[model samples]
Target chain A: MGYKSKLSWADVTPKAAYLNRRQIMAGAAGLGLGTIAGPVAAEVPLDREPNTLEQITSYNNYYEFGVQKEDPARYAHRLTTDPWSVVIDGMVDKPGTYDLADLLDGMDIEERIYRFRCVEAWSMVIPWNGFELAQLLTKVGVQPSAKYVAFETALRPDEMPGLRSPVLDWPYVEGLRLDEAMHPLTMIATGIYGESLLGQNGAPLRLVVPWKYGFKSIKSIERITLTDEEPPTSWNKANRREYGFYSNVNPNVDHPRWSQASERVIGAGFFAPRIDTLMFNGYADEVAGLYTGMDLAKFY
Target chain B: MALKDTINGWARKLPTWPVYALGALPPFWYLYLGFTGGLGVEPISELEHRLGLLGLQFLIAGLTITPLRNWTGVNLIRFRRAIGLLAFYYISMHLLAWLVLDIRDPARIWADILKRPYITIGMLGFLTLVPLAATSNKASIRKLGARWRQVHWLVYAAVPLGAVHFVMLRKGWQFEPLIYLGIVLGLLAVRLLRKATRMRPHRA
Candidate 1:
C-alpha cells in the first residue's frame, strides 16, 4: 500500500431504504405475529459492514455546537463555511492567510476508509476524501526551529451556542509533534461519503489523524500555527487526568473513568459484539515505529 | 371534579390492562423506529438512553399514585402494579442494552459497575428494584402482608438514585438531567409534607 489507499466512490453508498423495504415485506408475511414482533424480525435479516451516511452524518460531537450526540446535525447549518480561509503562520516561511480555494489549487483528494475511534469508546469506519497534511506543510516551507504544529477552530460565538457557556476554553486548539504532523497518514479532510462534508462533520477543512482519538481531528480549522513550544489542547486543558495530548487509541491504557479495552462499533446492532480496541486503532503497523522508546501509557 | 370521577371510573373497571398496555406502546414505537431507522445515527445508544429514561419516568409515575390520591382523592392504586412492572421491564432492557450493546465485554462490565460512580448508583438502583419486582405478584402480597408495604418502599430510594445516575452520566452541567432530578425531588417533597401532616395530633 502507498501513503493512502483509494476506495471506489460507489462503495460508500447507503442501502438504508432498500433494507427498510425488505423488512416491511417480511413483516407483511409475518402479520400473524403482530407489529410487536416486526422490528426484531427486521434486524435479523441483513449484515453490512459500512456505516450508513445517516449514521456518519447524524452522530457527531462537535462541542462547538453542543454536547448532545445529535446537536451538531441540528445546529451546524448556521455555520458559514463559504468564505473560509486558513491562516498558516508562526515558524513557516510562507506565513499567510490562504483561502480554501487557493489551498486546494493543485492537491489531489484521495478516498480513505479509516477507522475513527472516539476517546468516548465508540468508533466508525468513515470514507474520507482529502490529501496528506504533510503536502500542505511542505508547500508552506517549515522552518528548522518548528517542533510542533498547533491548530485552532473558527471562533463563532453566535453560531455556536456551546461557546456561550465555558464548557471549554473557546476556539478549540490541538497540536501534534513535528514528526507526527509530517507523518504520511496525517490528512486534512474536506469531504466524507464521496460528497462535500456537512457543516456538522467539519465542513470546508479539518484535520484527520486516524490513529489518534476523534477529538484530535479538530473541526473547522481556521488557523494552522507551526511552533516549537507544546500547544495547549482543548480537552487536555479541561481535564488533564482524563485526556492527554497524544490521545492515541491504546486498549492497554484505560481512561481513568472507563475501560478503553473495547469499543462499540457505530451502526452495529444492539446485540452486535463489542470488539477489542486495537493498538493505535489498527494503525500500529504504520505508526508504532514513530514512538520507539517513549512509554505510551505516560504519554496517553 | 368530573374529570377525576371519569378517570377513577375507568381506573376501577379496566384498571391494570389499559395502563399496562400504555407501557407496551413505547417499546413498540421504539421498535418500529429502530426498524425504520427513525432513531438518529447511533441507534443503539439512542435506544438505550430512551429506554432508561422511560423506566425512570414510569417509576416516577408509579410513585405519583399515592400523592395523587392523597391530594385530589383520585386514586390510581389499582394500576400501580402494571406501572411498576413496566418500569421493571424497561429498566431490565436498559441494563441489557448497556451490557449487550454498549460495553459488550463481561469483564469490563464488572469493572465499570465497581469503578464508575454513575454506573454503581444505577446498578444499585436496579438491584433495589429486584425484590420489589419479585414480590409484585398477588401471591407475594398475600404472603408478606404488611412486610410487602415496607419492602416496596425501596421505590423511594431507587427512583432518586436512578435520577442521580442520569445526572452523573452526562458530561458537565446539563439542564435536562438536572430537571429530572428536580422532578423527583419535587415528588418526594410532596410526600414528606403529607407525612408531616398525618403525624400531627388531630383536634376532636
Candidate 2:
C-alpha cells in the first residue's frame, strides 16, 4: 500500500547514496574507498532544499552519543541495532517486549517531510519514512485510562560515551500527551533519505514529533510505556527552566539564552537569510488544537 | 653583538603594513572558506566562532608585549600597536558576524545585547574596542598624548570581559572557554606582580 498527499517540497533528498554514510565513513577509515559520493538530485518537488545528507546525518544533538554536533556520526557506529526489541508496558493490553521488525511487520511506511526545529534555534526539513504512532498504539491495544505516552532511549554506556558522563538521568526519557502521541503527524521513524536510518540518526527506532523541538523526539528508543502519570523527560529533568515538558515550536516563547523568533536553516549558504519561525513550526493548523486555552510561554 | 644589533635594526625597520596584511589572513581564509562552501555544514556559525577566537588570540598577543619586554628583554614594543589594531579588526569582524549573519534581525540584535548577560558583556567588549580602534592612528596618538594611553587602558577591561563573554556563551562545564579565561587571568597576574615590584622602595 502507498500513501500520497498534497504536502510536497521542491527538494527531495536523492535516495541512492544518502543512506550509506557508514559505508563511506568506513571507506574513509582505510576501507579503500577514495570518494564520498554526494546525494544525486531527484525530481521530488519541494519549497526549499532539504539539508544535505552530510548535514542531516552529521550535525545533530544526540547527547546520548555526545554534545558536539559531529559526535553522533563519529561515535554512534558502535551501537547495535539489529534484532532490537522495544519493551511496551503500563496501561496497554499487550504489555510485552516486541521485536522491532515484528511490531512493524504489516504497517505501511510513507515518507512524511516535515520541519524539524531544535531548541538551539537551528532548523531542518527532513523526509522521514515511518508509519503514524497512532497505528502502532492501535496495534498494541491502548487501555482507556492511558493519558500519556512515555519513551525511554537505550542506555548503552559503552556504546554511547556521553552516557558515561552525567549529562542527564540515564536512559534518556521523553513523553507526549496521548493525543499528541496519537496524532497522525507523530511517527515512529525507521528511516530517512529513502533508506534505513543510519546509526547516528537513531537507527532501528526513534520518535519523530515534527511540531516540537528536535530534542523532544527521543532517539534509539528501547521502551515506550503508555501511562496515566506525566513522565519525567531527560532535558526537563536536567534543566527544567530551559527545557519544558511541552517543547512546542512557538517563536513567541524565547528560550532563556537564545531567541526562538527565527532560525538559521542548516546547510543554507553563508549569507542565507534567517527565516522567521512559525507557530508550531508551520504545523499550527494541525497541532494548535492540542494546546488550546493553554499558555505556551508557561508550558514551554 | 653586531649581528644581534643588525637583526634588531632590521626588525625595527620592517614596515607595519606587513603586520596589517598578515593580520588580515585569518578572516580572509575564513572568508575564502565561506565563499567556497568549505566551512562545513553551518558556515555562519563556524565563521562566528573562529573569528571570535582569532580576536581573542590577537588580544592576548597585544597584552603580551609589555610582559615580553619585561621578562625576556626582547623589546617588541614597536609592533604592539599593529597587534592591538589587528585585535580590534578581528573583534569588529566578530561583532559584525554576529550582527549581520548569526542574528539577521537588528531589533533582535539590540534585544539580545540588552537581555543576555554573555551578549551584554560581549557588546561591552566591542564598545570598548571601538574607541581604541578609532584612536589607533599616529595622528590621534599625537593629538591625545598621555590621555590616549589612559583611554587605551580599556583593553585591560575589554580583554577580560571578552573572555567572560566567551565562557558564558557555552553550556555546562566547557573547559576550553575556562582555559581561555585562565590565560587572560595569568597575563593580568604578570602585570599586577610587576606593578607591585616597581612600587617597592629600594635602599642605597
Reference-based lDDT, residue B125, model 1: 98
User: What C-alpha lDDT, on a 0 to 100 scale, does residue B30 get in candidate 1?
Assistant: 80
Off by over 4 Å in 2: A1-46, A163-171, B1-17, B65-78, B137-146, B171-173, B189-204
Off by over 4 Å in 1: A3-50, A164-166, B1-14, B67-74, B100-105, B189-204
Q: lDDT, candidate 2, residue A250?
A: 88
lDDT leader: 1
Expressed as tens digits, the lDDT of each residue in B74-162 for candidate 1 is 98898888989999999998898777656655667888899888889999999999999999998999999999999998989999999
Docking class of 2: acceptable
Write one digit per residue (lDDT tens) for candidate 2, span A1-300: 112222453346355654443234333323221232111111222244455576788788887788777889999999999879999999999999999888898787877777789988888778778888999999999999999999999988789988766657788899999999998889999988677998888988899998899989999899999999999998898778888999999889987777888787676666555677878887787888999999888899
Worst 10 residues of 2 chain B by lDDT: B1-10
lDDT of 2 at A108: 76
Cα lDDT of candidate 1 equals 0.82
Candidate 1: residue A226 lDDT (0-100): 97
* Cα lDDT, model 1, residue B55: 97
> Model 2's lDDT to the true fold?
0.81
| Model 1 C-alpha lDDT per residue in residues A1-300, reported as the tens digit of each score | 443433344554464652343334334434533432222222211112345566788899998898889889999998999999999999999999999999888788888777789998888777788988999999999999999999999999889877876678888999999999999889999997668888899988899998899999999999999999999999898889788999998999988777787776666544445567789887787899989999999999
